[model samples]
Target: MATDPIHQFQISRIVPIEVGSLDVSFTNSSLFMVATVAAVTLFLVLATRGRGLVPTRLQSMAEISYEFVANMLRDAAGTEGMRFFPLVFSLFMFVLFANLFGMFPYFFTVMSHLIVTFALAMLVIGTVVIYGFMRHGLKFLGLFVPHGVPGYLIPLVTVIEIISFLSRPISLSIRLFANMLAGHITLKVFAGFVVSLSALGAVGIGGAILPLAMTIALTALEFLVAFLQAYVFAVLTCMYLNDAIHPGH
Candidate 1:
């Protein structure tokens, strides 16, 4: 039987379990998340196990990833931001690996789900809120108060700023979720066309050529998008962390 394209996105329980009112069952999504984490951990551990003056390919790649995220944090939030390098780097690697892994056949796209992406977004914004208050105390409220505005306009501007600040997690989650969902759906539709058209006749087989070509092209584009989205997530994270560090203007 031809499987449904949408079925790829469905969350199925591998082991059903519950505690009180909460359904904390083992699921496909949960499995992929664990695999993603293990893959990243093993990649870094094995890559740097033999750190030497003459680095191997894995070592070089690890170093590049490290420097790339370090430079990103440095540029976005400055030297003080290096303190959060573990947080920023972990987020980048996790998202990047999750995105890339999802491109494989039969692998679940974790970030394609709204709940997963939303949780990640909330984790980021929550960190910003917690650290912002802890680091700057009540001064963190200054982030919502713009400088050099007229007294009469300050109230309106502050309200707008507060709304914008609150919308960060929503915007962040939606961007990742929508992009992944749309890209995968488009790819699936095109692929289905290839399969359906090939079954009709000789003419239909010839007609499938266009969709096949487009599918190939889209596959490449999706790879680029996967990397770009992960980078964007990490970059925005650094920018938000900057607010925690300098919560003014």
Candidate 2:
């Protein structure tokens, strides 16, 4: 009976303030984005405010997070990328918070949408291009050439490399979007089954209990998925950065 996609992902005009032509409507999705950012900001700010010698729970969380991104950069991109740790860490935290916040019963899943994921992917690809060109000047285009390939195979390998490089955004965005969409839709379908069966008599209602339990279990599983998807996005982005930094391999 709930048409609102489990009655959770509702789109609404929150502020009701409209510009002359801009029509800047504040949506539920926008509100959830703000909440996610605010929550993350508070968490990091409070967690590391004093930098205690004896780590508190919040401080430990902050330290763990810092080490995660720092080690990721160190392992994947080496010392040169240490300078870029802030960028990478911010990206990971933002995406992670966005995905985790969406797992709440009524919160909006920002990364579930293709446009949001695509925009983030575009940012990653754009950064790679900019950094590559900045580091290598005009020679950055040499990235498309295969290093060990013979002279005759250079053309074919270059074409494949070009396709692979160009498809980075496509690959990155699709992974997040498809996973989120599928998880949410599958949950919704199970929820519908629970509701429909529970509406009938005692036997039918008892039958619905199985799906109800499954839905609850799946909801918990989805929480894990939300975090994993965000981490996957960040790790893949870092891997792409590695390619840009040391190309032709």
Candidate 3:
């Protein structure tokens, strides 16, 4: 074995099934996505099914999640944004679970891939643009043309603002993909050290202990990153939605 931990990024076909025009091959990446979605749905559905007032731990978690997102939207986008809470809550939970699920042994990290993250960013940015236009029509264009700037400098400022707005998807996707990919790769690298060194003999086995300890520490940090990344994604999304709602503000 070469012992290069980064080599695990390969996306393998679990089943090379082909359907005439569709060619619906199952892949490791797709498997993780399905698992993440299933995990999120099962947790939420099962957690809230009882609707208990005394509340078990699962129910408490579910209630906390609801209040967190609901309050976030209310605070950021005001009462009008409450209508979109279901979509936003689901989005946050899905991403949170997806990132958290990937931290396990032998699990495929879907969020580590740019295609997955980019697709998510596109959906968010697309909704912002579409809703902005629907709500404001041509007036939505005014979002890029900020107020308080002199008419003489408006063209220059408008171009800069437009460029920045266009960059949103790029930033959002790259931040998530890079963080997930880096965290997993780091853990893998440390683990490879533990395996390779322990195989060498007594002295090497002593060195292996340190790598094992490091792996545990890194694993815990990776879990924190999973939650942080999800929170960042949800908060940024709310902020962007806020702009669409209050264009000039």
Candidate 4:
């Protein structure tokens, strides 16, 4: 069969298992997800293992990663937001590593999957909602009602705000999932073109040059997109969490 670019996204069972009606089989996706977690855990642990007055390169990297997310949360939600540092940092690292790991050949990109991304998005918004209510009581509903609006406009504006708030999870998830999916698919298609063109003859060899160049260029761009998407996901989560912190705004 001709290689299908979309086939790269397929989930295959690695170890079949069943518990009653549930097919809780281990899959390629599951394996990569576990690997991603293990990789991140090891990176941070090893990088920071030797905390020193004069930092080693790995320690510097670990510190840089910590400060990056810490500053992001601080800027978005202020000092109080630091309380959620563990949550935000974990999300950022997981997504960032998953993205980078996916760029490797034959590795599954968990974030590219809608279910995975949507679940993550839901967790973010769910945390916001739960904490908002817990911290602010009924006042948390103020998030859907802006301050200083004319009485007549308040109803309309509040409805709009509620819709926007509700749409966060969907938009957040789709943004990450779609970006990763489209970027990878484009890379694969261009790569396949290079192979297909090179197979033809002398003319084919000449034709392959364009795709070969495009593929190389896109490889660099894809790496950027991978990091950028992860950053976007983390920043947006901070912003959303900020709303929960200060719903009056």
Candidate 5:
């Protein structure tokens, strides 16, 4: 299985646990998730521990990330959305670190899983719905009714809007999950090609060079994609939160 492109995505139980009929066994995916959280926590703690006037490299990074998300939220939802900063920031950092960690050999990419991404997308949508209703009550339904629409078209437009809103979570989750899954699989396939080709005689070694180079290029591209996906997720989240704050239009 060393050269199997799909083998890397396999989920294996690291610590199998059986609680009656329920299999809540801790798997490689679980381990990586915990690792991602721990890494983010450690980085933030260390980054802000000193609070120096002349910021350290870690502190600079932390500050930049903070400002980046802060500006994103502020611009999208205005100052009111800053209330959800912790949630947005946490999601961004978690996804980013998880994606970065997966770049390492043998690390499980939790973000590549549909269930995981769906859960996160649902969390954002849930927050929007819960907070929207809590703050605006029945009027929050105004989100489905566009302004200045003719009375006859209102019903049809409302139905369309409702459908579009409902699709948000599915699209959000699939976008992240699909991108990571496809990128990793492609990377693995190219890497596997390098290995399989190199295993042959001298001519095989020479031919392996192309795939090896491609693997390296794909590796760098994947890193860029990791950050972009996280950013897109966060930006979309801010826009959704804006809907909660201002449900009209």
Candidate 6:
């Protein structure tokens, strides 16, 4: 079980709770999710609490994260999008912290679950839809109609647009889930190879060097991926929110 690559993704119940027919059990996944949120909250609070004229390392990191998301949102959705800064910032931080937490040994990756990522994607799309209609009324449907399509092609274009819009959540969710799942599984397999090889003999120990190096390299790459996935998710979210703000485009 220790060498099983798939074993690492298992979600064992930490505190089983049954509410009638529903199982509201708190599992390792739930614990890690709570940890992720708490970590992000605590980091932000502690990092900015001092707010010194000369910023500390934590303060600088916090400030840089703020500005990075701010700039990305602004560029994608313009100044009006700043109103959604809280949402965008929260999503970015939550995802980033969650991904980073998964890099630790024995940690359960919440984002590795399709359901979790799908739920988050739905939240973004749901916000865009609800806000779009509430803010623009029926005009929100204009998002599916292009600005300069010929009359005969409008129907075809509209249909395509609608399909594309509906697929957003699926694509968004799968992208994050698949990347994290695949990366971790690959890493686990390579590391398992190293362990199994080392156990064989003196000859086997030398044979383990390649897999060990690969394990180290993959570890570094996964860290990079953890950050990039969060960034991509945030950027795409900003683009989607832009449709809500300006449906004509």
Sorting all predicted structures by lDDT, with the top scorer first, yields 6, 5, 1, 4, 3, 2
What is the TM-score (0 to 1) of candidate 4? 0.97
Give a tens-digit lDDT track for model 5, residues 1-249: 987877888889989999999999999999999999999999999999999999999999999999999999999999999999999999999999999998988887889999999999999999999999999999999999998999999999999999999999999999999999999999999999988898898999999999999999999999999999999999999999999999983
Q: Rate the local accuracy (lDDT) of all candidates.
A: 0.93, 0.83, 0.88, 0.92, 0.95, 0.96
How many backbone clashes does every candidate have? Answer: 0, 0, 0, 0, 0, 0
lDDT of 6 by residue, 54-92 (tens): 999999999999999999999999999999999999999
Candidate 3 per-residue lDDT, tens place, 123-173, comes to 888988898889988888988998899999999999999999999989999
Worst 10 residues of 3 by lDDT: 1-10
The regions of model 5 sitting more than 4 angstroms off are none
Model 6 root mean square deviation, Cα atoms: 1.1
Per-candidate Cα RMSD to the true structure, in Å, reads 1.0, 2.1, 1.8, 1.2, 1.1, 1.1
User: Which regions of candidate 6 are displaced past 4 Å?
Assistant: none
The all-Cα superposition gives candidate 1 an RMSD in Å to the true structure of 1.0
RMSD of 5: 1.1
Worst lDDT 10-window in candidate 1: 1-10
> lDDT tens string, model 1, 90-119?
999999999998899888999999999999
